[model samples]
Target chain A: MSTQAIIAIGVFLITYAFIVTEKIHRTIIAMAGGIMMVLLGIIGQEKALQHIDFNTLGLLTGMMIIVAITAETGLFKYIAIWAAKKVKGDPLKILVVLGIITALGSAFLDNVTTVLLMVPVTFSITRQLRVNPIPFLITEVIASNIGGTSTLIGDPPNIMLGSAVKELTFMAFINNLTAISFFILFVNIAILAFIYRKQLRTSAELMANLMDMDEKEEITDKTLLRKSLIALTVTILGFFLHQLLHIESATVALTGAFLLLLLTGEKYLDKAFLKVEWTTIFFFIGLFVLVSGLIETGVISKLADYSVHLTGGDVKSTAILILWVSAIASAFIDNIPFVATMIPMIKDMGELGVSNLEPLWWSLSLGACLGGNGTLIGASANVIVAGLAAKEGHSITFGKFLLIAFPLMILSIIICTVYIYFRYLI
Target chain B: MNVAYKYDEKLLELKETANGDDIEFLITLFDSELKKRLIKVREFFEDNKILTDIHYYIHPNNKYQIIVRKDFYNEFLIQLFRQELLQEIKWR
Candidate 1:
């Protein structure tokens, strides 16, 4: 009830409201809030600096650079063409194959990058077959979220969680969530397939035409593709060995990005740098300071205490509560700040004598990742894909996307709930 | 036969001339010409069975730039405009 605490809460609420409304650039809102927090004496410059998670920022920037360079190589296009050929242009088959590819790609790479690479090609292939691209695009968005839940580096929330909880390793994430992610992917595809069954039929001639597409022709620069692929591979390998090698994920990612840049020569340095999303990075910076303000003011501790009290100190109930709450909240708001705030609160539970925090972490990851599929505005990837679709004259309205995606997202979360109960709660 | 068009690997730039010597008239003529070319390009792609889409942007300086996905088709369109069609269009 201190004035400073009240002011910090007020600032956080206003910033979050603007972010959800999306009336202005979130980066601007967040930066403004962080500055307000500092100006109000809620936190000092040094404390705010400590709040920014540079590892998460570095990893995001590095992956974005690599993806930007690799995207130009037409590798994504090539994969799309190849997948279309494999399905022989059958609409349902195309959906399943492309969904799996997107899911897998998102598991290893960022979801936004995965979708950015996939959506245009999906549009082109679907257009060629004279089918609507909406179903496939929606499926990809859902799959990207589910797939991203499977690994430490797959989604931003997971990355934040992994960076915060040192005990959570790359292998730990893979072992814990990969199976559930695949399960959700399969279920998601099946649901989409049934919904779009009528559109799944295409003419034999169109199938022949798709099969005739030369995937190699999609590659604009084979040399750059090779180099980018090599860099990505090394970075992934580095992630697997990060615990053993004593290297941070950010270091691995940045090294890989720079190595690829060097290998490709300096001609692309400027363009690659330009491709890094500075606005998103700044948003993260602002959010960190804002959340740090809550932590410093004892507000987060109070919330943690209330949550633990609500669950009556039972780990199972607490994990389940976190799962559902995180899922529903993330469906409407950006999960990054939510998770950033929740991490400390969850850690506080451990500090308050709640042993075995692994399940809580998994629940948070699953809910935050899969819940993003509930609405078009739920995740950054979803919004961008919607924007791209609209630009291409096939706009996916928010209600239309939510109609299909929300139920499917809930189904995925239900599956996660089951996995958490059987695998951890029992 | 002396009409000139500029060609690059991905884009074909066509310059417009107006008959009325009025800026508004010139802009209208340019827009109509751009629309006509876009229709033609669409028809051409339809005939050729090309799956790609055409995108265009008007430069700040009033040059009409048409972009195509395939390099070969871009070159082909440029050549077709230069050799066969450019001189037949009215210019002022």
Candidate 2:
């Protein structure tokens, strides 16, 4: 390997190690690692800038703005209450319904935002129903990760995949992954509901009390809701038609965000911007430059070459290996940086003789996104929910989450193994 | 039955009920400005990291509902007084 390649590998590994240790903030580590690459002459500053995927950052920022404002409208709480009332206030039934709602919400919004909105409502509903909230919280956390697997914009990994490969369009993700993701969601929730069925029971009196809640009262601002719905609709529609419209996903998202700001006027501008997870955005920015060092150094190509040779240039074995490895690795470490590194490697695999890259892309997406359900620390959504629940005195400890979620994650991977084998590999 | 708080309707109306060990408060604000006070009380609870201690809901025309745990009832009342929603508060 060239000296630059060796230095790039060293920088990348040190950065990855720091991120895994969780002692320092991940954004700081990622940014520091990226700066090292530039300062060490592994990659040029201008070339590193070119490597930053603005599409991913723009989409994330835009969606964050939209969800932040929409959240203020009390729409999420309204929907949760409305769904609970629909299920006749049965705790078990409410658990399933909330899981489904979480999945749907995460499919449209980001997983962390979806779970953040769900946690408070979960606590409120469980408190009212007089049942334990841990099951419901755990279910939502898993569902959020699975739900985030279904779309291009749902999970950070998928977003990176969509932006890195033009062929994997918004519709492409919907067509391939959405159905399988929901199928996994159903399987996971069924098991959760069965396990927690005993804890889900509540007195008829409590049920009636929950029923008495006025969901209509939850709409804090109808005017804002209407405008938000309009912007959200246009933005989603833009995603559906973005490929046909020959525009990038980031443009659609930013346009939708700015349109909402226009309709809502300047009042929401600062709030929306404030609500954008700038730390996450910077993390992505740093990761791009860090990965560019490896790419520019030809290290990623060498790894791809080795991987292709190991799989004997076989598509099925390579796809399965990628899928399983991604799932297992993502369960322990952050998937964003993992996917960032994999994207270039996979692209290189294409040049190295992988005739069908379709299955490979889908495998990476499924494995990385759904793999988060394996443990409490697997994904940001899981960690956020655990922290919030612990703060509320309902601790979802690492061991407890692993005891339940790990087996289910394995089961999910088994199902994916079947789906990928049948749907794509065949 | 315990009176959670006594408030002038001009500022806000506090209706209380007991559900097991928890107290539910359905607050209606007559003056639009009192919404800020209610928000302050909500922020106080959130700032303390006591998420489940209260559930705050909003209704049209400046109406709000908050359910408080019995354990946090005293603290909740103190917040109302602090935010000036309650003109005065007394022990006993």
Candidate 3:
């Protein structure tokens, strides 16, 4: 390698390590790294912007607006309440309901938005019921990641992976991956339930003291919810309808959001969308450019070549390797960019004649998604959830999360490995 | 077998009025959706008047449940619960 290549490698490693440690905001680290590469002329400005996929950004923005509108309807709250009444303030019920919602939401949207909305409600429910919210919250963080791997629009990483492979369509993604995704989710739900069973069961006569103080605010305007629901439903249906009918995903999502604004009369729309974290968008864009620097300078290709050789070009071996590596990497670094980076590496493996690329992709997806459950900083959803929870004064310590999260994440990964390889490889 | 709906709406007459027991009322339901919203709405009560708790084996089916303890039913809460929100789904 040339001296410039050596310097580039060192810069990338240092940035990667700091991000895993989460000693600072990833946006700061990633954006700084991308700019450093540009200043050094490792890549030009135009090249970097090209690396920054506007489709991913646009898709995310449109989806966020839809979720924002959904939140206004208090549907999540309603669903949560209905679930609790069914299980009756049971911790396991909280986990199951939260888990299902997180996974489902992540499948349709992204984990960050899903968890952002779920965490407070999780905290509220658990706190009211006088139980630890850690387990249920942890499940949401885990399920959201795992479930997000199923579809193209579900997470940034999936989107990056699909577009990197020649802009794979929505149906192509779901058809290829959703079955494995459901299997992973199934195992996750079962294992997490077992882990939190004890703490979730502590009951006392004084329990009712923990209930939330306001039922009134949940009663938002009726017309708003109805209209929001209609718009949101149409958008989701439109996503699935793309193969049979010609509809752009972005146009559908944005139209729903805008229509929601018009339907609800903007009063509620402004309040909801204002909470959208635009900084996250910048972070994704910056990281794309930074990773592009690696690809441009040939680091990604070299790594991919080495990875294929290391696994002896066996799909089974590669799938297992990706699962373990991604799970660990995701536990520390943000999974979106990590998964995004892995997509190209996997394609490179495919070029080297790696069979069963589908299973290998699923392995990477499962690892990153479930692995994020292991650490507080592993996924944006976790960080956002933890941050939002802290703002509510409930301190979900990194240490505490690891205590519950690590085992669940590992077990889930293992389950994923068996299912994917057994079903897909042999 | 008539298993409890994973969720249920119970009109508790107070764990007390059964003959004035100091602990008031204890309302229980299986794990389901209302669990979260019910918890959110709990904050409206005066601190000591209501209580809630999370239990793992709230049911024999291995699912969880949310049980609320309240001195008495609050009408405002009823109206709020009944509010035609997007879809405030509850179980019987």
Candidate 4:
């Protein structure tokens, strides 16, 4: 092993440790690690810059801008209230509906943003019914992660996968992962509904009061809502057809963001940009460079060679191994950096011996995304929801979340194991 | 705005209007002490992470408008009493 590779490994491990401990802000740690890679002569600054995946960043930013503006129109709140009424204010039924709504929202938007939109409404609706909000919040967190597994643009891991591998397009993700993800969502929510049934009961009078709510009045601005819907529809449609349009996903997303800005005029430009989650963007930037150090130093190839040898060049075993390892690792640590390192390793595996990489990619996506439900700190969405719930005096303790979510996460991986074995491994 | 609950006619006045599913409260406080209490009420909700339930708008001449969601009404009143803005809350 070269000295540069050794230094790169040291930097990456230290950075990973700090990120997991969460002693300091993750953004700072990741950025510092990336800079260390450059400063230590492991990777050049320009080479590191070349490694940054702008497509993922662009998609994230565009969707954020669209959601930030759309939120002003009160669309998400309106939908939640409307869905609650549609279920006749039954807490159990509303639990399922909100889970489904949250999943759908996360399918199209970012997971954290979708949860942020859902959390407040979940609290409002649950408070109105005088039921405990913890179950509902837990369900949404799990659902958001599952939903984010279904599409190229849904989760950061999947987004990074799509950008790194050209064959894994938006449509390809929908075709391969969406159905399985939804199936898992149904199974997970059903169990949640059963477990929380006792806590979900409400008085008939309270139910009646919820029924009397006027969902239409929740729309704060009809004109802005209309414009937002138009832009959102076009952006989603663009994702569906980007492959045929011969355009990159980043272009589609940026075009959608700019189109919305144009429609709303200058008033929304500043607000929309301000809400773009620049910290997350920079986090991705730093991670890309940090991983590039491993790639440039040939460490990824060594790891890939070792992994391929361990599996004896069998695609089926390699796929299953990757899936299980990703799920277990992501359950405890940040999946973004995990996936960042694994992408190149998997690519190297393809070069070394693995003939079919499709199954491997899907397994990675399923494991990494679903693994987030294993703990409260497993995903950004989970942590955010827990923080908000704690602030509201409803504590979702790490152990409490792990007890419920870890078992469900194991069940989900079991199902994925079956799906991958039958659908791809066979 | 229709008068919903008036703690004191001269010092604190609360006028309520129903906007869709939420109750918009237009609170006018002639006394600065009442204003301080109202600010505390806002902080309580904010601290609880229920930000959308209340909005505080400052106007000239010490006028304030706070729109609260109907779901948070009871809790809001409880907070007012907790802050000593209300001597007691009665069930109507």
DockQ of each: 0.06, 0.43, 0.04, 0.11
Residue A6 lDDT in candidate 4? 97
Candidate with top lDDT is: 2
Kindly list the per-residue Cα lDDT of model 3 for residues A237-336, writing each as its tens digit.
Answer: 8777765676556666677777777777757666666756687877887788778878888888888899888878888888888889988987887787
- For every model in order, what is the iRMS? 12.4, 3.3, 11.5, 9.1
lDDT of each: 0.81, 0.91, 0.68, 0.89
Question: Candidate 1: deviation at residue A19, Å?
Answer: 1.0
Write the residue-wise lDDT of candidate 2 on A164-266 in tens digits: 9999999999999999999999999999999989888899987987877778866778999999999999999999999999999999999999999999998
> With candidate 2 superimposed using the best TM-score fit, by how many Å does residue A182's alpha carbon deviate from the native?
0.4
Residue pairs of candidate 2 with colliding backbone atoms: none
Residue range B1-92, candidate 4, lDDT tens digits: 23334376778676667755667666667887676677677668756756457644443445665557677877877887787666644445
Ranked by lDDT from best down, the candidates are: 2, 4, 1, 3
By summed lDDT, the worst window of 10 consecutive residues in model 4 chain A runs over A211-220
lDDT score, candidate 4: 0.89
**Candidate 3 structure, TM-score to reference:** 0.75
List, residue by residue over A1-426, the lDDT tens digit for candidate 4. Answer: 999999999999999999999998999999999999999999998999999998888888888999999998979988998899899999999999999999999999989999999998788787667789999999999999999999999999999999999999999999999999999999999999999999999899879867867677567689999999999999999999999998888888888889999999999999999989998998999899999999999999999999998989899899989899999999999999999999999999999968999999999999999999999889999999999898777999999999999999999999999999999988
Candidate 3, CAPRI quality class derived from DockQ? incorrect
Q: Candidate 3 lDDT (Cα, whole model)?
A: 0.68
- Worst-scoring 10-residue span by lDDT in model 1 chain B: B19-28
